[model samples]
Target chain A: MTLTINDFADLRSAEALEAALRAIGAERYHSNHPFHHLLHSGQLDKGQVQAWALNRWYYQSRIPMKDAAFMSRVVDPDLRREWSQRVVDHDGTREGVGGVTKWLRLCTGLGLDEAYVRSEQGILPATKFAVEAYVHYVRERSLLQAVASSLTELFSPTIIKDRVAGMLKHYDFVDEATLGYFQARITQAPRDSDFALAFVKQHARNEEERQQVCEALLFKCDVLWAQLDALHHAYVLEGGIPPGAFEPVREQGRVAA
Target chain B: MTLTINDFADLRSAEALEAALRAIGAERYHSNHPFHHLLHSGQLDKGQVQAWALNRWYYQSRIPMKDAAFMSRVVDPDLRREWSQRVVDHDGTREGVGGVTKWLRLCTGLGLDEAYVRSEQGILPATKFAVEAYVHYVRERSLLQAVASSLTELFSPTIIKDRVAGMLKHYDFVDEATLGYFQARITQAPRDSDFALAFVKQHARNEEERQQVCEALLFKCDVLWAQLDALHHAYVLEGGIPPGAFEPVREQGRVAA
Candidate 1:
């Protein structure tokens, strides 16, 4: 989020702002993170994959709360109405099906315990921090910035496709059924990002506003990237699991990369 | 911070509470973290050491703020006055020398840029979460729990001893002058924790209170431990530095570490 006033001269138009935001996703998004490559290419073992899903469940679990936080700050009934759909999308109807539910399915598919995933007991503290920071960012920052942070969805579809297809194709334990979360996201992310992208592009009236918009996206990218960084560092690089985090139960969970 | 009602039986007495807190420290303190092992024994490289100092500066920088937060909730002027010394210890007199200033000396001695360290631009996001979570913990938890969180200071004297001695002996870049921070801490931590420990012991009225006291210390241990986890994860384990974190400058910075 390092935008200075002098560095702010070029993003005065919505076209330029859109280009800048897309450029940020292209450059800084978590898709570019190595963990994603490891994940998408089936380079990770079952434990690493389980670690990814369990930790990611924390992020997925928090999405509705982040949206609820964003909605809490909205004074306009119209904005709040539009924002409530994100909550509905994540929390689902009274049927109790949502992104978190589907994510738990994925975790179960990876051989993670559903109750344990729901309990969030074993996730890394960094995951808590990064995800909680996202909630805080929405509650504390401007409405426009809150809207802009969700713009990462603009880039999620391709990653979702790669992730779903990659998991199914490579990992024998995972089937199309387990990747239901990504399937929902495939359509949902574009619709959500279309709305958020237009909001950011339309409301960022000047260079400073545009820069703040870009910073919000950058901040969101860091949030996603940092989670993987923690996972990779703890599980892959050194296995220095913090005290009280989940230890994976090994099974037919890994796919040969 | 994972203390439940059933895990509550053992910590019933003040003696038991004190023992529990210390045991938690013995088991969970950052001193037990391998990053500290690497750091204390001179197994880390220059970049790792600089990364440690720089990232730690963020925590050191927040100490007075956390103390002031604890002080703010105090209604008893006597208690407030006793607590004010903590603020004074870190913030110092108008002479502007204190723990943070001393810590910057340590950082600068390790060849880190003083401004960059102060800017906190390169520290891990987990460091922010862990540290900010400390501040939030002080503000949001019960006053007794807030004081109990400082109980990690109970174990700090020895780590300070080991850190000072080990760094000086192992790392050529460090000397006594650079480690003024720990020298102050060597006295300050025990005094502060003595007051806090006494407060926790005297005031924890029941098994539930004692359990919470233990939980606070455990949470503080997590706070400290999580920062090192991030440092180890980013600098030592994988060098997978998160985007925008500090990159160390090479000089006569590393010993065998």
Candidate 2:
């Protein structure tokens, strides 16, 4: 059945809400985007893949910030305690260990400059906009919706698996080590998404609240899908790269010493 | 001269800063984008034009919100009063008027449903993110930088002129009435942009602040360029329409009832 906002106006049981939220993922998640199809099937060249990794670093780096925004408004110590782990997962207890660092390694492995990737100077303007929208959403929305937005993580493990397998099999630049961030996230996303899903199911008691939860999840999916759309557009289609975004350096043969 | 953050960090005169800002527009504004070139040259078919108008409505509709967000943070009565006119220009003093309503007229003139346009359901996801990013930028950044971002208006009159003349000259579906918004903006943007420009000049006194003012203008240009990039990618180049964005209905031959 096609889902509409009106359809969720009547109270839904927790199970029903959960199912609706998952249905949104099944229908709208970034995994379904054509760019991902190209990415997984080795259709994109190294420069194109580097563009994806560089732009995505903007999103990955902001996870801690999004989580921090959520945690600042959250009052419950137990909820805060559980939620703080997401920050740690992304940022790590120390430098060079967390998701962001691993992502940087992936970029460097693909021959991108570490400083350029970190500066976010070369990312597509769309990537910056969509990722920042997520942070602002967490900062400004109701705490329940903030938590609900994180539900995209519920669909991540499968994408991670497919990505890691596909990248390892198809691309020689990427190996298991370069894909460490996904390996870490395969476990972390589920743990975080589980808590968030439970929190949303528990807190979204009324129909209006449930609808908000569903909308939040769908919004998160849009954020993810928009990024890939940008990648495909710039790197794959007409090569209409906006001024000042990353231009991958195609390595020429080394000079004989 | 190549514009760099460091170039402005040395504290240029107001004339130099203004020139740099104008240079950025010459190089980077959406007016310079190939899609706009196609649009003004009337290379895009009616369906393609509909997609442009429909997606652009999201940006036009949010102008008041972005202005309001900027105004809410301004403590000065004079500044707030001057900036408030932007909201008025877009939203108008009454219903069935203003820039947004005029934009809808253009959409309807192209045969799109008004409610569907207003609902923003057909807008590219990238458009929503980029436009909302503008709103959030105004809300979160320093008031001077917020004002600087509006300096794109300095470049608007020429674009508006070209767009109107080109559309009226080349397309039968478009007439002066359908282009009311550009006609209105041709006068309004310069007036609003002049006030903003003066405010930015007066407020951005130091080297770092000048750099920020320039950077803010560049960022705003990116916001505009990215929207057109998305349109060209989705409708023009690869036909990789994201699942739920506007799909224009082709008018087939009349059928016997």
lDDT of 1 by residue, A141-250 (tens): 99989999999999998888888888877788888888887888888889899999989888989988998998888788888987888888778887477776766652
Candidate 1, residues B1-257: lDDT per residue as tens digits?
43322354787589998877777777788898988999999998877888888888888889889989988999999999999998888778865597778888888887776666776667777788778878888988999999999988889889989998999899888899988888888888889999999999999999888988887887788788878878887787664777666656422232113
Model-by-model DockQ, in order: 0.43, 0.54
lDDT of 2 by residue, B1-257 (tens): 32435455555777777877887888878898899999999899988999999889899888889989888898889888988888888888999898888888998888887767777766888899999889888888898899999999999999889999999998999899888888788788889888887787788887678889999998999999989988988888874777667665532111101
The best candidate in terms of lDDT? 2
Please list, in the order the candidates appear, how each scores on TM-score for chain B only: 0.93, 0.94
Q: State each candidate's chain A TM-score.
A: 0.93, 0.94
Worst ten in a row by lDDT for model 1 chain B: B248-257
What is the alpha-carbon interface RMSD for each candidate? 3.6, 2.5
**Per-prediction TM-score, please?**
0.92, 0.93
Best by TM-score: 2
Writing each residue's lDDT as its tens digit, candidate 2 over A127-235 gives 9999998998999999989999999989999998999999999998888888888888888888988988988889988888899998898889889988988888788
Please report, as a residue range, the 10-residue window in candidate 2 chain A with the lowest summed lDDT. Answer: A248-257
